[model samples]
Target chain A: MPHIDRRIGFMGSGQMAEALAKGLINRGVVTPNQICCTDPVQARKDLFRSFGASSYDTTLEVVHNADVLFVAVKPQYVGAVLTEARPHLTPRHVVVSIAAGITVDMLLDAAGPEAHVVRVMPNTPCLVGETAAAMCVGGKATPEDAELVSTLFSAVGRIYQLDEKLLAAVTGLSGSGPAFVFLMIEALADGGVRAGLPRDVAQALAAQTVLGSAKMVLETGKHPGALKDMVTSPGGTTIAGVHELEMGGVRAAFMSAVVAATNRANELSRMG
Target chain B: MPHIDRRIGFMGSGQMAEALAKGLINRGVVTPNQICCTDPVQARKDLFRSFGASSYDTTLEVVHNADVLFVAVKPQYVGAVLTEARPHLTPRHVVVSIAAGITVDMLLDAAGPEAHVVRVMPNTPCLVGETAAAMCVGGKATPEDAELVSTLFSAVGRIYQLDEKLLAAVTGLSGSGPAFVFLMIEALADGGVRAGLPRDVAQALAAQTVLGSAKMVLETGKHPGALKDMVTSPGGTTIAGVHELEMGGVRAAFMSAVVAATNRANELSRMG
Candidate 1:
């Protein structure tokens, strides 16, 4: 468990920050009163205030108030925000950044060389409490800082501690992968509609099937191929569908999507 | 909630029957003592016995003992099992069949015309308590029987009441869809590994990404395309990946898989 008394802060009160704050409070990891945030937009600050958390207009106030600060600004704004709070950076502060293309070295450069930093790549599903997130610690970060970040992230979804080099793959697989799945679900519903089901019924069933299938994979800890075999009987409809998917080259399509996304992430990081 | 005291029985103690029984007991819909099963295999009967449910060797005994009977035999054996229990079935009995490709007309024919029947198409995720099921009632079934069936199936996962004509589509979408999704998840993991992630980490993220994305679709009541747009930024990783999926004909592939599966299901039903 993370420290209940720790004051958590967000340098930017964006959607991702709001999601983390909501998850942390909902999971009883911290109280609403223990959360603070900074955002330039008045409406965004009001959104945090509506949730019973304190919100501010500048990064320095959040830095002064919080022990663990999340850098949740857009990638372009990350360096500016961290540098604004650099003077207040202390050994007590653990800075965690969720900016998409920003690396730990960049955060360390902006927040000062002695500052503790952790870089995380989280998907949009954090809003729905099922995020797949990965994190890696900077040189200045302690093991306790890594544990705290892991605990905080696990409240939203499953989190993995991995080498920083793997974060781009995480960005590809869990980050961009959601869009690929959304497309697949829509296509599946279209198939059902074509097969005589009502549109709404098809959509609901399509989404639920994806949810259930993913749960089976996670809970069984069985190789997905083994799980697929469990559902496919000899000469059954499942095998027929699987055959069509194979003939259509669905596997290669998904593989290519991930590879493209990872390459793009690498490109974006280099540009950042 | 369905009647707590109503006795439930499985006409055949197969994997599907066990899953429903476990779901019912776990959800507090029924007690183990309220459940009964009949199986020719001593091992299967013993498995039910081990779970504190009464098991018998004869369908007649189960029919006489239980008010709500699940016709869980294989498609080929449904006729023989229902015929054997025909004399024992009464007006109080509600026959719910999960036999794939076996129609209500066939069940009614085997159990006698006055019999109440409901046909359901449930996927393999029922074993994990995340089933996507659809059911339709026969002419002899009452509204109360339909409600009871809905309640029972909902305990395992989401259930829809639809016309019998659309069941082939349901079978294609939710029934056979899991295997397709499994193959996609595996491919996504492979892509992640190709991008430099460890295999275990890649697999976990891939599955969680699917689960979370599906949850966003179900929980937000938003169109999947809109959700995809939420994650996609201009010239970003998600759109890059989506572009690859589009170029690879991923959507058409999924749509064709469902259509192919539906056609196979229709063929199997005709043969049955």
Candidate 2:
């Protein structure tokens, strides 16, 4: 990964945008002084300014100044913001959208044919420096443009290069998946409380278990099934617990959650 | 956290013993020669030896030489091993047991009243330097003794101090819980795959989401429900997906898994 020193700007200053800006500056990818963002909401603009970043009231100022401009607004606002900044966007500028259900073609249409557009679907884990984010290249996006976008998001988490068609699936899985895991951790903690452990300790242990197991999967590069088997010693407690998860249909539920979310994303984009 | 320089020894040189030896040596708590272990299997002994730890074929040698002695044998073998090493065990030695269902009281009974006994239930993620481990002090153990054990395990992962009565809950939640998480992550990956993402990419994203979300829960110290709400906007993909998870009984299933595993741990200890 190249060390990015370019000025990064955002068209919105929501939590997602702040997560990226804070992550970039914290990792020394870019300093706060190198970050500038635009937001109509005074409080949102003030929020970004708290990180030592410059804030603007209009989108064109951000588009004109920054080398990489992030379109981080709501899905419904992407077209309007892109159109407002269309005249200022240059071929050298990379416009990346973090808004869900916003298509690369729609962004390209609003920003003009020469502008480089990259679409991203990032989960809230970006705030914790462990986000799972995916990016898609637009019609005019160069390989360098894709690299730059990946590098920016990579500062916060793992980045996957994706096709526009597959971005909805990414939205459904990693995008909405954090909430599911949070719920599971919460429920696991509840079980611990019921079993006689203190609330705080159980939550801590449950969260750590999820964090560690996820890391084991990435670090070992072994199959998850193999790792699960490693812990399940024949007729042991782990196997017994696994039987409950299986019988409770956890696997099917998670599968359906992603599918349902993906269909919802597809519908939103279609409506847009 | 005091830096532990005491000589550490393992009575059983299995994967658990190797993990501790390697972690202690890696963290510079004790040098390779300062660590010693006894095991019947040559391969297991060789594994610890690779980390500069001395290998012995008898349990008495490990109990005699080290200031902190770890009894890492199987549950059925813990009593016999402790009984054989009882005469060699002194007041200065802190005898720790990592075997499941082997209570601190049982260890105290085998090793006699003078030795300090501590019991731990740690998940397999200790191998990745991010384990969830809990320790309980026996009748003869002092606060300093607990501190030493906590510092030792803390080198590889997070440690929680609890009563011996709560160890079964720890076993079910964090001990056997890693397997439950691996299954959930695999199931989440399966969901991602069903939603049209590639198998490897889907698995990677799913694992990262779990890892990141877990970090969020620990770092933010906020309620998991609040964190879930932070990601879920009105009519957004996350909320839509969360609804599916709610409909699918994910929380109930995870709660049942932990409860079942805890019950199993209680039963196993009773049978022992």
Candidate 3:
């Protein structure tokens, strides 16, 4: 379990911050009162207040109250928020950033050189408590800080610790990958409708099929190819479908998509 | 909960039958002693015995003992097994067949006209307790029989009651869909590997991304297209990846795969 007494704060009380707070409280990792946040939006602040956490209008108050501070603002606003909180940031604070394209160096520059920093890429599915997240610690971060971040993230979903260099690949795969899957599910439901199933039934089955198949891969510890083969009998419908996917170059399409996304992440990071 | 007092029996103790039995036992839908089975393979019978269920040598014995009789034999052997147990099957018996392409009429022909019958199409993910299943009640089946079958299947995963004409579409979407999604997960992982992620890390992340995205659609009760749009931002990595997928015709490929699979299912059903 994470340190329940630790005061966790968010620099921006956005949807992502709200998800993390919900996970922490729901999982009993921390008491609701142990969390605090700052957001300019009145409605967002009220949302945090509904979670039994204090919400403020200033970064300084969150920095003062929080032991672990999350820089949860938008990518463009990350620098400004961290810089505003830099003066009050101390060794007691471990600053974690969920902002896309924000590097550890940028965070350290804005948060002061001595501050501990961790950069994480989490997907939108965090709202459903099924996030796929990955994190890398900065030069100033201790092993304890990494552990704390890992514990907090595991509450919502699976989390991996990787090198900073691989964070772009993580962005391409788990981060942007959810959108790709959503497209696939929609397409599958469309196919079902095309095949004469009612739209609602088709959509429900399409999503459930994706969910179950993914569970097979994760739970069975079998190779996806092996699992596919297990279900594909000779002259069967699965094989027929697989043949169509291959003929249409589905694999190449997915490969190109992931690579393109990774390239875009690289471009954004460079521009940042 | 399913009727815990009702006895369930499998005519053939194959992997699917084992999965269903395990699900019923694990979910407290039924006690192990309420289950019985017969298999030609000694190992399979022993496996059922390990679950504290009775293992019989003859299908007649299972038919006599169980109120709910699962026609779990392979498609090729279903006729022979059902015919052998036909005399024992009474109005009390709800004969549920999970053999692909075997229609409710075929089950009625072999099990006797008076026997309540259901034709179900369930995928291999039943092994992981996340099965996607659909069923259509036969002419002799009562509403009570349909409810009982639904209760039994709900223990394993989601179940839908649909018209018999739509079973082929169900076979295409949920039945063959898992293999398609498995192939996608493998391709996604391969893409991650191409983009510089470790193989294990890439595979785990890819599978989790699929699972999380699917959960978002199911739990949020939102259209997958809407959810996809929610995550995409202007000039972002997700949109970049999605653009590549579109350019490569990923959606059309999926639609074609599901349609082709549905056509194959129709052909197989006709042949049967």
Q: DockQ numbers for every candidate?
A: 0.87, 0.83, 0.86
| Whole-model lDDT per candidate | 0.92, 0.88, 0.92
User: In model 1, what are the clashing residue pairs, if there are any?
Assistant: none
Model 3 / residue A127 / CA error / Å: 1.3
Q: Write the per-residue lDDT of candidate 1 for residues B107-173, one digit (tens) a residue.
A: 9999889899999999988988889899999948999999888999888998999989889989999
Candidate 3 C-alpha lDDT tens digits along A31-61: 9999999888999999999879998879999
User: Candidate 1 or 2, higher DockQ?
Assistant: 1
Off by over 4 Å in 2: A41-52, B28-33
lDDT string for model 1 (A1-272, tens) is 46567899998888889899999989989989999998888898899999899987778889999999999988889999889889999999999999998999999899999999999999999999999999999958999999989999998998999989888888889999999999999999999999999999999999999999999999989999999999898999989999988988888889889999999999999998
Backbone clashes in model 3, listed as residue pairs: none
**Candidate 2 lDDT for residue A266:** 92
What are the per-candidate TM-scores when only chain A is compared? 0.98, 0.96, 0.98
State in Å the error of residue A106, model 3. 0.6
Instruction: Count clashing pairs, candidate 3.
Output: 0
Which 10-residue span in candidate 2 chain A carries the lowest summed lDDT? Answer: A1-10
Error of 2 at A95 (Å): 0.6
Model 3 C-alpha lDDT per residue in residues B1-272, reported as the tens digit of each score: 65567899999999999999999999999999999999999999999999899999998899899999998989989999888988877888899999999998888888788879999899888888888889999858999999999899888889999999999999989999999999999999999999999999999999999999999999999889999999898899999999989998999999888999999999998999
Residue A258 of candidate 2: its Cα lDDT?
Answer: 90
Query: Ten consecutive residues with minimal summed lDDT in candidate 3 chain A?
Result: A1-10
